[model samples]
Target chain A: MKVFLKLALFYGIINVFIEESLFNYPEYFPKTKYDFSKNNLSKTKIELGRMLFYDPILSIDSTISCESCHSPYNAFSHTDHRLSHGINDKIGKRNAPPLFNLAWKSSFMRDGAVNHLDMQSLVPITDSLEMGNSLDNLLYKLKKNQKYITMFYEAFGDSTINLDRVLKSISQFELTLISKNSKYDRFRLGEDHFSDQEIRGYELFKKNCSNCHKEPMFTNYKFENNFLDINQVLLDSGRFSITKNSDDFMSFEVPSLRNLSYTYPYMHDGRFSNLFEVLKHYSGPKFNSVSLTEKETIDIISFLLTLNDKEFILNPENKFPVNKLLK
Target chain B: MSNKFEKFAATCGFFFKYFISFLFIFFTYNLFPQENIEFQATFNNEATKLNKNYSIRKYHFNIKKLKFYVSNISYYNRKNDEIFTDEKVYLVDLNNPKSLKIKSQINKKSQLYSFDLGLDSVINVSGSLGGALDPIEGMYWAWQSGYINFKIEWESNMCSNDNNQFIFHLGGYKKPYYNKRTVLVKKRHIHRLIFNLNKFLKKINCDRQMIMSPSLKGENISNLIVKSFEFKK
Candidate 1:
């Protein structure tokens, strides 16, 4: 009896420690690209990150936070606008990308500018045309918040706000935005079945778009010259602007095909509003590039619809975190 | 009554021992410092004259800071007869070659040392936060939505009507464009490679102000920097 009691106590303590230390996800995914070893995730950190995502404190004049462009309902992507709107009603060049399943992404943004998730938030916070806020000023604002101070201390042992802690906290929350419960994922896991049309669409997608879109995670994460003509006004050369390689002319990051239903205004510039428009663009003379066939384009669009995961978008966990913040 | 008392005592004693063991494990894991090395990145421009043709009147060169946490830094001596090892090596000031310093943090009980480099060791040791947070790094180019890890800007008279300017923004962190380079230092020789920024400038003959993104140039600046790194005796 004494031995059993002692064993029970030991197990209880171990369980508490395990629950506090790490986050475990499903087994089907690849190893995460974000190095969590440097910035350990805690419950408080995730909460703080979520609050920051919803708060506009990150922007200049406190007008826009990450949520301004990436709303929760739209899978953390803006729905109404083609391009992202920044502080002082300024408009950015590219469309805001949806946020989800970030752990698998090796880079951030449509251009793949950031290599680490911990550093991804800096892009919107500092762009002169974006948020237009400096890091030091943002830290000062975070420090002023009594709630943030307590939360930061809880998440990172000390409330002392710095760039690393702020970035890491936001990363922690973003990592939790995993969208695995989609109908497509259910079909993959044998939990559900697809209709005949959906199955045909899946087959067509595998044949044509899977080369770029891939499986489970919808992107091969490669930059390809998708053959979209350069916008004379934006003059956005896509990947060519970064690499300076002529071959990369008109190349863009292959975005994930998931959440097509909610994450509308597709493409890098959000030129296409619906899947049909996207199909039309792919099939039309606009795509003068040597990439796709008409039939293949239709199939790829059909397959993209299957990527939508309603359960993820509706999850209350990822919602505004109002209760926690209010306290 | 005596037997019951003895059983209670035994259970309490067992619980106490387990609690102590648990505390030990918890404290040791959290308190112990794992081995890590600190690295610094510095930027410098050694160009004396701006090329007229390239529109580059002055060149501004900066090195992006990076930290490589290694278990040990060991090399073979000149004769290759023996191996000399330093457990910790830090990446020091990357911009200023003269200010770059790598120190080994030594473990008192073992052959381990903490390695640190540069003046802003702590800040540089932290990681890259894209364009929003830090501006000094120049890791972001908003029009492209990616980072230009290394940027060199120069004033030139090549392209512009008025002895104009030339700019080469070297960047691209993603696939087919990831520009991180590696270098190998031989045991005893000073291996140095010089970047001929002037050569690229000489091509245009100071006629047009050249605004060139290195990503567009297809030139490997990483290769230039890696080759330029030499081993000092």
Candidate 2:
């Protein structure tokens, strides 16, 4: 009996340790806007979501997956492609934004159309240019698969796979993508020191870019009109499409500056291939314009590079689960 | 032998407890009579069946789909005192007979006076709901995160585009374009709440048949939908 009690105590400590490790961000970051109480994070659910994220079965034709455009290597943001490419080589209207630190965001998409992370996947799944699949069709396919059935049962404690469970599980995996291990984070923690150029760049960044981009999380999580002349072809009318308000006509969700090195081909339309173009646009004729010299832009770029979380980008846990997914 | 006997006794006690609770619940449920309130979609005072051709104002069309959400049902007694309220949202689809009827616990003396034509703002932002509110139900708009309050699909020669299709998916939970309307009716119309599409179809401007997104048009149509609801005499 004493041996059994000791074993129970040991098991309890291990369980607590695992649970605590499930979600962890820096203490300096603001409280997450996502209500975790609605769909509490669990290891099984996250693993299931990871499989779903990597699997192409989520698409209508078993061709495109979330990872297809939002590749984990490019900090979960596709590079080279100006606009997101979906099944049948159909081009999406907007760039596939990088996925990280999503819990802090109250809304999703470039237009801030999706009000919740749980519902974000539905947009991509059903969009005719994207996956071109419906929730019912996706659920039907998932239910037919033996692997998904077992995963659903393990994640939800039932084999009955519904739309809510599928969406919630996908969100669980996305919420785990908290990029808080950048060089700037270490600098804040007093573990690292910045060089003279980096320090100057940091100061410049604080002065010019911190208002919309903000701190720690690197985004104020608000929409901004960055003054990219609307593409005559795409003619995307950003947040105005969702809210139908005139003020939001050119406004788009301000993206986070984290993992800038990996996530290139920036902006809503992926018009800028590098940081120089983006800076130039800001310095040009635009609302809330900032005038910056060549040296100032270079210095700011150096500081922005420090926001790249190398550890997060290369983290094997965030990558495809080859072993489990294959099995 | 004693351990086996104790296990058997414990199992029996568990069953006995559940049995007693079940009996109490059964009796309690039977004590109060439940009421059935049904939403019927009608055209010219007749059941509106899907794919049936109807003519109105030189436009001959058949409704391919008609679905709407009826929520926040409240019943009032003679003195206008709130007797019972049902917070459950019912999705009434022309294709599905099972979803047309809503079961509520109400005193026979009470009558439903008013109900919401669509899901409220709270449920709109709640995110990833199950049952009738689930996105798989096809009532949810994928582009914008909100439940479609009402949907109308028609195949008509009046529409100039897309194989002569006229569709209206009216819903917006946000401010300035809030489309959820409160539908009020006479107390006598409680049992069989009717939505006559003849009154609504006459108002549809065939020139702009596609109102898929939330706009002033959707808001205006939502108001017209509220006006279309009438209690059966």
Name the docking class for model 1: incorrect
Compared with the true structure, what per-residue lDDT tens digits does model 2 show for residues A1-327?
999999999987776676569988888999888888788788999999999999999999999999999888889999888899998999999888999999888889999888889989998899999999977789889989999999999988889899999999999999999899988999999999888889999999998899999998888889988777888999998998887778999899999999988988999999999999999988886645589999999999999999999898888989999987777
**CA displacement after TM-score superposition, residue A265 of candidate 2 (Å):** 0.9
lDDT of each: 0.63, 0.87
- Per-model TM-score, in order, reads 0.65, 0.90
Candidate 1, residues A44-152: lDDT per residue as tens digits?
Answer: 8888899988888888799898988998899999986899999888999999999998878876677665556766787789888789987778888888999888888
Q: What overall lDDT, based on C-alpha atoms, would model 1 receive against the true structure?
A: 0.63
Q: Which candidate is the best by TM-score?
A: 2
Provide a comma-separated list of chain B TM-scores, one per candidate. 0.38, 0.82
For each of the candidates, give the backbone clash count: 41, 0
